[model samples]
Target: MSAGLRVAGVDGCPRLADGSGGWIAVIIEPGNAMKAERIDRLAELVDRPEAPQIIAVDMPIGLPKRVGPNGRAPERLVRPRLGMRQSSVFSMPSRAAVYAALDPRLPDEAERYRHACSVARATSEPPRAVSRQAFHIFGKIAEIDGLLRERAALAGRIHECHPEVSFWAMNGETALDLAKKVKNAPHKPGLALRRRLLAAQGFAEALTSPLQARALKVGEDDLIDACAAAWTARRIAHGQAIGFPTPAERDGEGLPIQIQA
Candidate 1:
């Protein structure tokens, strides 16, 4: 829709057997927000002629070099900011690990795990390991990677954000006492906490409505994550976002490999 400057938050997940996995973008205009999914939906929002000022997505934005690797610089820098929950920021799987995850002949889950870890070790300094969780989500990572690389115009307008970091910052940048949310954790209280923080920012209605949260097919945590990202996007578009590295490190392709919240 042709409109004034808006901001957005996007999160992605795997494509389920039902073709259900994709991206979810929470768009925030002056006083309105609508949730959407898929790369096409993301394009519809970010590719408009007027386009949003900034669209923050909860995905790793860049890849490490073929050689001389340190995984990603921002992960190292952003860890301290996350404090007690620093482990929430996993070292992004190197580009090689990403491609390896897509291999069809990887056989069983163990084989896939081995391949991913091996690639990560060879590509990173001190060898960052890709969690099984991270390996499973590589499809989403690969999808965003393709979109950003193909549609170069989205560069300056789209930024990388980590939801936990966003949530921490939203709550005055302090550590949370609760445990990290698990998928089967009885209705996710973590979402409730994050929802409260977002409500304070005026996204209360969207986060509270069942119909609204179901608009995106991703998991509950992913939806809350997208909300946290929206909060960060609001800051960036309004010139209040805090960048992890004073001068962000960019990938060889020039995509910023930094975290912002």
Candidate 2:
């Protein structure tokens, strides 16, 4: 890889008061300078001028037709290594379930959630339903899934990554002691721990600072998560990153089914 290659780290963000939500991205340039932006669509990141060479996104990829007991291969492989943070890993349902959940005719979110769970239970081996956390992000998952299926060229550049897994890799392959949130609220100690880890990876205060993220409607935790993913993107660009499974699996659509960090 050229020393001038650019990479990005991205995480889904909360909706604005105007009923719009999207992803937050941290684009790391050649010299480590960063650009943080809120993009309303995943395509915006991929289609922008000077698009990133590698995109390490905190979103699920590669939906399976029938999920096994541990969900997809990647979730099962990395969850155990996360310790308490394992809860952050949601078991992905089948491709049909995901597509059904995002059906425009569903009317509302609650209806979509219920409909998705019904499909999920029927498609999963152990008859599992989708978690609320996971269900909420089905649209985001669908966005990337559709993008990969449509643009074969992007399949290699855009990768699935989890912040906790990225953080675990950054913390010398050990899980962090604290949770990023408690009762759905940010935990300062945990955020501090993550910031320290990112700093150790050469991230400057400007990129990781909470105040800078707040103005953009991006949560502090999310900003930290995006930075962690960017760290993984850097490692990947340098051929230093590793996938959850020793060898990545593939979905029916041929999308890679492994999380890399």
Candidate 3:
């Protein structure tokens, strides 16, 4: 593998429509297969390089500071829950937080909270069904918590897995914020650079095969997340490290974290 930064974009539970049911796609390079695999695959890919720089994911990496109403406000929030099994509810809040934290500007706390709530509502099944599903998959509510804890644990593991690689969670909000800033800026060399970034993302989509696209079905949100991840990776390759925001710190609108490598 080349010594240059190796970056991967992960989009999980990507939906095809407004309703429930979506798939996950891990786009390593343009036109790659959208295979269903563990997040560890990302780590594995980065490890191939002597010192991979970054791996950006679209899944949630943290839990809410406090649970919402309805037994866990975040849990109750995922929108379309039609065909989804109850077990998926366990991943909702963290996913929302992950998405929210990736954005640079969220407008305000209310916007951030609303966005989180909306994501939760969209991903979760009905309350009773989710409770039953959790029991079936985990044996009890406590077991569900265990699963959640494990998911959160990955935040620390990203660096450990590759040692040389840093991880970031990218979401739609961050992408939009970045785009706005880049697009609104006065005509300058930076505008061309921004367009190049978007072009790379589009190239990635075009390179993707029909079968892969069908399988991954990268949606609007997923595409934006992937673009942000790609942009972050590009920055890392150029010697910049991207930081993630904490749920409390995000006002729900601002520039995404820009970290130093």
Candidate 4:
């Protein structure tokens, strides 16, 4: 507990365009309660640290198993649903795949694709359909590419903001899911309490930070998810207990993997 802990969180709206594709936020706090005395204190804890433990990001850190007809590849893979009209979809990679791809890029390339496959799968839709959908979402024929570029830029910004923390990728699935996960995860009393406090702070920040509010285009759900990810990082850093995935649990893929903190 001598050195403080640093954690990062990222949220992505794969379906959305407008650099508003999603949001990423990082928080660093001291082991002591006095760390919350001021906003500047919190920023200093994250920015000035030498090499802290645990940074969590909420993006697809790898490419999907398939490629779109437009020759654009998925940043992460998701399962196909019946009657879904989209050519490429927003899906998550398997935990094994995510860990494999992201672990090597810790604290950098936090947005790069790492997995390799012998063959690339093609999308079901035609090139024109893909183009139409992209245009519909982004308001222009070429906006889809612009959105992807913006997402990458935001990911790069998060990495640059905290170069010293060991980054981990996290996608809570949902705010409620993240809340339940962190509430049940085991942790030292001090760290656990700190997480709760951080959660409250994030909730507040969501309302105040113009960027987060504008990106979410809604209430504080995104903030809650970001905070929950930070709490999960705290539990992971302390080597504390974490919850298990239910029998029905699955990643962006329908495949199963072990859950950890």
Per-residue lDDT for 209 in model 1?
49
Clashes of each: 0, 0, 24, 3
Per-model TM-score on C-alpha atoms:
0.84, 0.97, 0.35, 0.34
- Stretches of model 3 off by over 4 angstroms after superposition: 1-3, 14-23, 26-53, 64-197, 200-205, 208-212, 218-224, 234-261
Query: In candidate 2, how many Å is residue 13 off?
Result: 0.4
Question: Per-residue lDDT tens digits of candidate 1, residues 1-261?
Answer: 233458788887545567654676677776565554544445666667756678898888887765244347777877776777777787686777887877889768788788888888787776666787678777767766777888887878889999888887888978665544654462556667777777888876655444565565456676777778888888887778888886788777777788899
> At residue 42, what lDDT does model 4 achieve?
19
| Candidate 2 clashes between residue pairs 3 or more apart in a chain or in different chains | none
lDDT of 2 at 38: 85
List model 4 lDDT by residue over 132-177, tens digit each.
Answer: 2222222211122223344543222222111011111222221111
The C-alpha lDDT values of all candidates are 0.73, 0.90, 0.34, 0.32
The lDDT leader among the candidates is: 2
Clashes of 1: 0
TM-score of 4: 0.34
Residue-level error in angstroms, candidate 3, position 86: 28
lDDT of 3 by residue, 139-199 (tens): 1122223343545443322310100111111222222112212333433342233334445
Worst 10 residues of 4 by lDDT: 159-168
Q: Which structure is stronger by lDDT: 1 or 4?
A: 1
Residue 91 local lDDT, model 2: 92
